[model samples]
Target: MKLLALDTSSEGCSAALWLDGQITERFELAPRGHTRLLMPMVRELLAERGLKPSDLDALAFARGPGSFTGVRIATGVIQGFAWGLDLPVVPVSSLAAVALSAMEQHQLADGSGVAVAFDARMSEVYWATFACRDGLPAMQGNERVCHPENVSLPDPDTTTDGWFGAGQGWKFVDGMPEAIATRIRSIDTSLVPRASQVARLAIPAFHAGQAVPAEQAQPVYVRDEVTWKKLPGRE
Candidate 1:
């Protein structure tokens, strides 16, 4: 499956082209320059693979609970590119992408349940729990938007057999209970959601027939429910 993916959902801006079974990725830390840096990465990846946008099987991106501007930038770019080329698009969750990244770093198998958290700023974090089945994250619960202090380790009393914790948020907080921190087989803080990872995720979504049309494209802004302002309507 040939796919192109982009992620600007944090300080990182990354792009990738997945051709046949090989992957080519480019990433940089441009905290506020994604809008400018992203397209070039896209162009380079496409050119490197000797392919055009139309030759791509699908477009993928980081749909998020991270930066509001970053998520918009990613989805907007993804939509513009995918729609213009009339290709299918798949949106991967920023948190889930982190979990996937963690798995890749540790060489974990298909059954490792990963607990991932990204520093959401404002003393809060964007967190989620996921398990790998065939090297992909099958989230245990809905992604969460919560404060760090309010977040707790999953109950070993009920969830999966083993768990791992990763992402920046894991490092931000202090004194993680031993039960939680110790359970972690590995911690990869350098890992962040990247477009390349999202493209890798699209592989399954593509064969599963999960790609959505451009007009139906949406952002997963877990932090906001008030973006739709009180309209000029009965209030």
Candidate 2:
């Protein structure tokens, strides 16, 4: 099966092509240039592999819970491509991508849980928890947008030692609960959702027939009111 994926839901913009089993990807930390970079990256990846939009089974993308404009850029692009090619669309969770990255980096075993939090800016975070089962990160609860202090495990009774924290939210959030903080084996602030991870996660969904029409593919901005203004001297 061949699949194409893209993500611009964070500081980075990335595109990936999954052909049979081999994967090819391109990623860039273009906080303000996703619009210019994403399509070119996609075209380049496809050209390198001699694949066309119609040659792929589906197009996948990180749907949301990151930068508002970034998320929209990905959603809009994927929707346009899918709509034009009449292909199915797979929407992967940005947080789950982060969790998957952590799992791959730490080489965690099955049954391990990961808490992924992305700095949502405006003193808030987009957070979620996932359980590593069969080498895939399965979301434990609904993804949420709220203050970091409000972040907690879906099941408090789950073994804390099995939990890990990841993403920039940990860096911005102050005074995290000791119980949660101590249990996290490590926290990676540098990780951002990537298109490669989105493609990997989409494999199962694509086979499971979880894809939707391009028009139905929408961004998942957990926050209701996404209004924010940039502060002076802050990028």
Cα RMSD of all models vs. native, in order, equals 3.8, 5.5
Can you write out model 1's per-residue Cα lDDT over 1-235, one digit (the tens) per residue? 7888889988999998888878899999989999899988989998887887878878888888788888888877877876678888888888888888888888777767788888877777888888778778888768887876666665674345577777888885464555566677667777789876788788888889888987656788776662522112313
lDDT of 2: 0.86
Per-model TM-score, in order, reads 0.89, 0.92
Error of 1 at 24 (Å): 0.6
lDDT for 53 (candidate 1): 81
**Which parts of model 2 are misplaced by more than 4 Å?**
156-161, 226-235
Tens-place lDDT digits, model 2, residues 152-211: 876656544478888989895465666678667777888999999999999999899899
State residue 15's C-alpha deviation in candidate 2, in Å.
Answer: 0.1
Count clashing pairs, candidate 1.
0
What shift in Å separates residue 17 of candidate 2 from its native position after superposition? 0.2
Model 1 residue 174 CA deviation in Å: 1.6
